[model samples]
Target: MELFEHLSLGFGVAFTPINLLYCLVGCILGTLIGVLPGIGPVATIAMLLPATYALPPVSALIMLAGIYYGAQYGGSTTAILVNLPGESSSVVTCIDGYQMARKGRAGPALAAAGLGSFFAGCVGTLILAAFAPPLTELAFKFGPAEYFALMTLGLIGAVVLASGSLLKAIAMIVMGLLLGLVGTDVNSGVARFSFDIPELTDGIGFVVIAMGVFGYGEIISNLAQPEHEREVFTAGVSGLFPTKQDFKDMTPAVLRGTFLGSALGILPGGGALLAAFAAYALEKKMKMKPGEVRFGQGNIRGVAAPESANNAGSQTSFIPLLTLGIPPNAVMALMVGAMTIHNIQPGPQVMTSNPELFWGLIASMWIGNAMLVILNLPLIGIWIKLLTVPYRYLFPAIVLFCAIGVYSTNNNTWDVWMVGLFGIIGYSFVKLGCEPAPLLLGFILGPMMEENLRRALLLSRGDWSVFVTRPLSAGLLAAAVLMIIIVMLPAVKNKREEAFVEE
Candidate 1:
């Protein structure tokens, strides 16, 4: 009954004219970026971050949340139609989604992605609403030791779950940590590696690194590929709904994905991407039979599972950010900044003191999901047409947008130049077969990990065993160690190599 009352209040807040409008705008903008290959929600949100300053806190957050999931919806469109995934979470979809397109099943594949996403999103939101308060309460008990251990577990999980060589993943993580440390030391008043640059004192803007590597970096990598190898949208989409078999096959996949994503999303680091990849892995392991189609060969479950998983994962990532004042990913870190900008401390107190923002954000997700379904379903034809735009014309526009976005962050040209440099570095990572996503996770977590580690040490009076003495922290560390060992085993190593080769 209390839950009902809270939900009713949330509805009242979300139904306001301004909030609804913001939600609509976010969905529209998110879809636009999602349809374009190489552009991601992270970059788009970073570009739009400055614009949100004028908005009411609830309205701004509602809109930003809409953009996040809306991009997820839009990414599937390109993945299905053109074999291009604008977001990392959508990469798994490209496998079967493209194959389905080749077999003239693009319409069904797309419909499955949309419907599965909507269903799972609703379920995930409900789970979030139900679980968040208790989690917030639990978060109150965490000390510096717990946080440090949690981050360590998260980093390990990110590397293990990322799709690539373990060595390369570790290297990328170390590089990210190094990059994160380039600014002034927070504890001491001394500069670490700023090279005497004024901008370095404030640290590298997340926008610069994200856009350079994810946005411009992707553009350069795509341009380097032979034109003949680039997949084009040639399939004529005829239907707007999935068939009976597609519906049947996708139902279980969606449910499984929702459960998996919701659980994994609460974990720190690469939650959405890991959930998507893990869902695909689970579906492949299940070996569900579709009519005359193999797992990676135009299977509807492939599209449904990952799509559902990513959306669910994206929604549940809010758990840590809202409850504990801890950001599990770069996007969540940005959300923390948003909250701080509004003078709201993101912790257990938020739920009690700012019920409007908490429940309101939850309610807005349902509204935004509904908006995305209505907006995206009818616009499938429009998104498909976006594939017709030539890469030559598209790449320059993307680069220009990235530059403008980076510059707008701090009104500094230095950040823009840094973006360009990172773009080259991003391109290099691609050429070397390194996964940049883990680097992002590492960079986001490094500072938090350092702060927590130092605080834990201080509390324990320099005791090195504090991490191992705490039961919960020790358990998480053990699990992380076990995960590392399992991944390094010869059989598992070979299997991982084979999976990447297939991708």
Candidate 2:
């Protein structure tokens, strides 16, 4: 079969010695960072983006993929141990996961998380393998009009699905789109919002925004918290995994989460955070075994559902990036940057032109998932020790490294200073309860939207009807409008916000 042949090629590439080593390194590093509260994969990957320039394309992607999913694996540990989420997706896990730890069921809770994640990751990957080809085919049919319409849908999805105030999310996205317009116009060769700064002529660097907003923003937020590091749990955490009955209770939750997460992960703005929260909420709404643990108090279903959903979501989030060259989340946006660094375009042609890199990256995810399971369980002790380190010492070193990384991106101190200014903006977003992920999605998509819209108009000789005349493009635009309307309904808006709440 075509799929089998592709897998053979993928494994051959992913199994190379160098690729395997990087995979191991990435998994280990991701686990380490993911165990530390307040640091997520976006910042970590952004920190390491420069380092990947030295790596072969396959190896670079293999390692970054490991970090992305490995964080999912390591995140549950902190959620269970310290009542903190290392990744945003793990936030829902903390509700019941920490309760399990408190009730002396940490071992079982962790086992459920690990096992559920591994299973769901495999299913998500399988779904990706089966569906990506068709999606890629569909993508090839798109024109400039269709692309603009699809991007409209994506931006709307980001606005509707983001977890804070809808107004704030919209504002953030509009800001990102506006900021995306700060560079020189392609057709006119005139600067729009460059403010006469040389660096602004090329637009703001995605790396700087990512590092400043995700990295430095997180540092400031963490520093603002009081110096109160919780002691790591040692007892009830070292032994006693799930029993037969526990497995019986967990199997259904894992299945539900995998299906739910796989479907949601393909949608714009529906990444691990949304999937996890949705799955956890759905589990609570469904009927449970009469004698089982209650919803927020050491429920294995709680651990399994969110953990599985997050991993599934993390894997399936790649569909948009790989198929359409559109990034569905901040992490996928980072992956787009990675692909561009290697001079590989992140679209349908990638599969036809570079099958090895594409398939190998897919295969590497399964390998990374396996590696995460092996690395996370045995290295739990080391990860726990990392959490014990004080923020006072940890944050300064982080800020210093981030500064160095941003400056190293273009070898310009101006970029570093710009990152500092963005850091303030990032912190302001946090204090105002605004989510930055949608802003990131908007920033990444804005330029692409403008280019396509311009192209569509040019092709149509300035005819505005071109967007509505094409059936496919019109359908997509209609869906975008429908989505916005659905989300704006009072009941749906309430439920949407409520579903994304951690607890």
Candidate 3:
């Protein structure tokens, strides 16, 4: 009953003319960027962040949140049509999605991805509504030691879950931590690692790093590919709805993905990405018949499962940010920045102190999800048409937008230069087969972890055992250790090799 009352109020706020307009604009822009390969929500949002300075808090957040999820939806379009994932979360979808497109089943594959995302997104939202209060209650119990321990568990989980060499993942995380430490030391009022640059004192801007590493980096990597190697989808797409069999297969996958994503999304770092990978792994482990669509060959289940998981994971990611004031990913960190810019302290108190922003955001997610489904379905033809544009022409436009977006953030040319530099780094990571998402997770969490660790040490008088002393924190650490061991085992290594060979 209370939920109903709160939600009704939220609807009143979200339906205002200005908020509705922003939501529409954000959804349209997000879908456009999502259709383009390499460009993602991070870059788009970072570019738009400055524009939101004039918006009411609710309207701004509603638009940004819309872009985030709308991008998730748009990402699947490219993954299905062009074998390109617009974002990391869409990578799994590319395996089966592209295959389905090649086989002239693109429509159904796309339908499955869209429908599954919608289902999982709604379910995830419900879970958020139901469980967020309890989680908020739990967050209130956390002390500095517990937060430090929890962050430790999160970092370890990110490293373990990340693809490629564990050593590389750890190195990336350490690098991120160091980068995060480049600003002034809060406790001591002493400057560290700034190289005496004025901008360094305020710390590297999140907008700059995100734009450079994700936006420009992706552009540089894509450009490095030979023109001939860039594939464009030209096949005629007809059907817009999945067959009954697809529905039957996808229902269970959607439910499973929702549960998995909802659980994983609450974890500290890379939860949404991890949820997608884990959902795919779980589907494979279930072992459908040999005649069933092959896992990597554009199976509808493949598209459905990961799509659902990523959306569910994306939605539940809000749990950590809203309830605990801890961001689970770089995008969430940006949301924290958005909240701070509005002078809102993100914590349990937000619900009571700013019910309009809190419940309004939650309610807007439902509205945004509905908008995405309506906007995406009939527009499939338009998105498919996007695939016909020549890479040369399309990429230049993307680069232009990225440049303009980054420069607009702080009106600083240095940030734009940094973005270009990161583009090279991003391209290098692509060539080296390193996953950039985990690196991003590490970068975002690094500072928070450091702050909590220092606070814990100060309170505990430098006793390292404080982490282990807390039961919940100790359990999370144990689970992370177990996860690492399991992933590194000989059998798991062999299975992973087999999967890669199949790919």
The number of the candidate with the highest TM-score is 2
RMSD in Å for all candidates: 2.3, 1.4, 2.5
lDDT leader: 2
Tell me the spans in candidate 3 whose CA falls farther than 4 Å from its real position: 285-292, 461-465, 470-502
Tell me how far the alpha carbon of residue 264 in candidate 1 is from the true structure, in angstroms, after superposition. Answer: 2.8
Error of 2 at 413 (Å): 0.7
lDDT of 1 by residue, 154-198 (tens): 788777767767888899889888888888887887888888888
State the displacement of the C-alpha of residue 490, model 1, in Å, after optimal TM-score superposition.
3.5
- Candidate 2 regions exceeding 4 Å error are 229-236
CA lDDT, candidate 1, residue 474: 88
Candidate lDDT values, in order = 0.83, 0.87, 0.81
The alpha-carbon deviation from the true structure for residue 32 of candidate 1, after best TM-score superposition, in angstroms, is 0.9
Q: How close is candidate 1 to the true structure, as a TM-score?
A: 0.93
TM-score of 2: 0.97
Candidate ranking under TM-score, highest first, comes to: 2, 1, 3
**Model 1, runs deviating above 4 Å:** 234-236, 285-291, 495-503
Count clashing residue pairs per candidate. 0, 0, 2
For model 2, the run of ten residues with the poorest summed lDDT? 228-237
